[model samples]
Target: MRVLGVDPGLTRCGIGVVDGAPGKPLRMAGVGVVRTPADADIGERLVLIERGIEAWLDEHRPQFVAVERVFSQHNVRTVMGTAQASAVALLCASRRGLPVALHTPSEVKAAVTGSGRAEKAQVGAMVTRLLRLDAPPKPADAADALALAICHIWRGTASDRLRQAVAAQRLRTPKGTA
Candidate 1:
């Protein structure tokens, strides 16, 4: 499956694309970071995110969008920014009629580095090795985004999908003990 992973922020949003299946190495399609000037108004920053996300979707045409979940924080300001960013990212996927999956930081870290406590550098190194790339993905945020994509690919719920498909098929059949 083709997946678009996003690490969202008010001033800088990172995005990455990859194709992979469960228990397989992810093939990196591309990685990019979108930046808005710190001095820009909040509205302008949000607009930038919306446009940048749309452009990425158009270019990648991913089958799924994987996003980091926003966690509650002690700092109100930090929480607000993260919440807003997450909302916009989800909106972007919904607008495109794409399926979205969200994972926690711990889940992504563990998936990328085999330990939830793995440092950013460790995660980056693992991402490079797992993808068999010449170099590590640039900008820590972009690396994190790529990691998210890899995590989703590795941990997707194929069995759940199968169950749902089976239920739909049963519904289509006539009432009988087939």
Candidate 2:
């Protein structure tokens, strides 16, 4: 499966594309950051984010999009920008009719580094090793994006299969059955 992982932020939204399946070797199709000037108006920054994400969608054509779920933070301004950028990613994927998954930062860390509280450096190192890259992707955000993709490829595929199985089983059961 091909996945585009988005680590959304107003100043530097990270974007990465990875191709893989559970128990299979992974490949890094692409990785980069979408930067918008910090001084730009909120609406303009969102527009830039939208365009950047759209371009990635056009180029990578991922089957799924995995985005970092926005969580509460002490800095309201930072959180607000993150949430806005995240919305852009969600919008872009939905417009393309692609499946989108939101994974928490801890979930991504756990998937990549075997610890929910793993440090950014650890996650970056693990991402590099997992993808067989010569070095960790820069700016922490970039590695985080790749980690999100890896996590989804490892976990989302199984979750999807389980959901399908449950639906299929329900269809097979009688309507009046519990």
- Using TM-score, give the best candidate's number: 2
TM-score of each: 0.86, 0.89
The weakest ten consecutive residues by lDDT in model 1 span 159-168
TM-score of 2: 0.89
Q: Model 2, 1-178: lDDT tens per residue? A: 8999999999999999999999999999999999999888999999999999999999989888899999876499899889989999988876555778899999999999999999989999999999999999998899999999999999899676554455446556555632
lDDT against true structure, model 2 = 0.91
In model 2, which regions exceed 4 Å deviation? 161-178
Off by over 4 Å in 1: 159-178
